[model samples]
Target: MMASRATARATGSFAAYTVSELTSLIRASLESAFGTIWVEGEISNFRLAPSGHTYLTLKDEVSGIRAVVFRGVGKRLGFCLENGLRVVCRGRLTVYEPRGDYQIIIDALEPKGIGARQLALEQLKARLADEGLFDTARKRALPSFPQQIGVVTSIAGAVVWDIIKVVHRRFPLADILIFPVTVQGQLAGRDIARMIRELNTQRTSDVLIVARGGGSAEDLRAFNEEQVARAIYQSRVPVISAVGHEIDYTVADLVADYRASTPSAAAEAATPALTELVNRLQSNHTRLAHSFSRLLQQWWAKVEALNVAGLDPQAVLQRYLQRVDELETRIGVCVMRNIDRVKEHVLGLCQGLGYCGPTKHTVRLVERVSHLTLRQDKQIVSFLETKSRAVESAGARLHALSPLAVLERGYAIARHWPSLKLLRAATDARVHDRVQLQLFNGCLLCKVQEVQQ
Candidate 1:
């Protein structure tokens, strides 16, 4: 505070200026003297503040200048600032009244050479890489066969067309959904990032491919932008970054699950080749056929080596039929013997009841036996009638299904003479040739006078 007062007195303006007035006057003088000056220096002690402003020291060989980038101006600076980076800044000078210090207020910053963009890129890589965004552990492998492939690229560009062509050539069954977004210019990054987030909400793709054709670094800046990089990192589906030629690289490539050299290569990586799949299927089929053929041969050899005492399949079947018939005969004989025994028991019970009433008992037993006999006869007759009716119904159904039924509808069947070949059309019978005609009633042998179509 004493130095400020002494400095003001030495300048002969102590009585004329207050502390705030002196600082303001100096700030105005500096601004008027150099409204906007360009300075080239190497940045040192660069730091970003919580307030979104930047604080830095711009130094040349023997001198250094304290510089500040306010939050609003700092926001528009495209590249990040770092120590040791040579930059050209455009800004005016201003004085801080309390501190009584003059510093350059930087409005814009640009790197010293073509390597400026590279420095920005390296800075970004270091940042996101530190956050583990580029870690191999976060990367995912693509599906063996993607059912639905979502693409983020410019629909009007050749990159999308190339991708479609390659994907179809490799696996025609794969479904492709293209989310056309800007791939260049200032707004491109935001558009691309939004598309990715939107696609995640849809969850429609088995895999995603973000691609753009090869171009200049500036033209491909969207892929390098932080928004696009984070978007790729946060994607739900595995993303393949195919942004440029093999020689080019972007932050997007680093954050993506897979990095493809070209758009077509990305498509190729996402799907299996159709021809190779077909070949594999055919190989499997052949192996299965060979296995079944060998199995059949083994069983046939076992069959040929077996001997069953001159019994063939037909003889074996006949033996089984004979056994069935014998079982049926024995069952019938057993049933008849049981019936006779039951009748005898009944007769004995009636005779033992009363010897004087033996004649009446005998007569009663005879009547009961006659009633039982009549019931048996009626049951047999009913069973025979049922079987006969079933046979007649079956015969009627067979007649209805037969082609001979067509004859009953006044249709006749004809065949060529001696050939026994049924004639289907008039042209089938030649003129003056003998023909056999079959009707519902009988057959007729006749000579054809003419054949007409």
Candidate 2:
């Protein structure tokens, strides 16, 4: 009995020591596993919650792992988080206390190779800059008063309407042409490029604006495509790019002749306020009138002075003649003092028609009248000539801008007969429908006898 009790006591002591050692080892292992690790992957399933926490999945070619960057760490990240972006993340592996599952708690993140989109943008910018596409010298100045503005954008999008409204508000005289095209998805870039080329070839517009409203990176990707950028660079007409919000930048923006912060801004840049221009013109007219009036007054003063000086020349001649007559009379008075001197002098004056002669004054009055009449006639002729030239020049300019000029240049305008609106396509007229054909000389009204397939 004594030997069995001693064995039982020894077994209990050994069991307690084993349990304590295992517990210590497990604690140490947990500590080692929870330390920091570096991971590289493309971002996916990114979510930023209202609670200021971010959750995302990082995946490589084979596997993905869940990660969370609390509000504190997320706030420290300078760039925006987006899916498909390759990045390197620094974080620690930890088990969620509630679910008891391991996840990465990201403390920091940096773009892997500067991010794909950013790298592509930088490379394109460099290439275009080298080709002088982005050179300020190559950029065409926006028209101060564009008569016809063409817009290239999606037909269904609000951006087109926004541009129209803004342009109308700023310059009602400007004619707007909407060139509808796809602005998103796979074929959007090609559609835009095609429209730009067509407008350039036709010379249908004074200026072209490629525009779209703001959206996420993917939604705005069509504007960043190289094809669209090349189209903008190759355009014969000046192009204005209005792709997104003020902070956003795209390849089209860099290649375009001008960049506007938004669609409305693009419209504003394309045209000017008619009302403000009118006000400025009125102000200038008033200033010109004031300046002309001052000049006229100065000229009138000079003319009046010349007329007074011419009139006084006769008075100067009269004074000199009077002095000579007085000297002769004084010399004669000493020789024949009382031999009827007063009577003889009176007879001589009567024969000479007096010192201030009516004949000379009459001649001066006639000359002055003739001079004034000649000046008035000259002024009238000059004014009429100036007005006639101005009218002729204005008529020539208006004729040049007339739509009929296009028809005169070997072009025909097809219009719907009933509505008299220009027909853009042959489908606008039916097989039996009548249509109006406007040629250079005259209009021809024709009824379709047969439809051609």
- Candidate with maximal lDDT: 1
As for candidate 1, its clashing pairs are none
TM-score of each: 0.57, 0.45
Tens digits of per-residue lDDT for model 1, 266-307: 999999999999999999999999999999999877666554
Give the per-residue Cα lDDT of candidate 1 at 428.
80
Task: Report how far residue 188 has shifted in candidate 2, in Å.
Answer: 1.2
Report, for every candidate in turn, its global Cα lDDT versus the true structure: 0.90, 0.86
By summed lDDT, the worst window of 10 consecutive residues in model 1 runs over 302-311
lDDT tens per residue, model 2, 1-453: 335556878777422335444455554466486687999999999999999999899999999988898998877674567799888999887656444445688998888978645666666677777888777778999888888999999889799989989998989998999899989898999999999999998896999999999998888989887789889888989999999899989889888999999999999999999889999999999999999999999998877786777766557679999999999999898768766887798889987887656988999999999999999999999999999999999999999989888888988888888889888876777887888999999989999887665
Q: Which 10 residues in a row give candidate 2 its minimum summed lDDT? A: 13-22
List candidate 2 segments past 4 Å from native.
1-113, 310-453
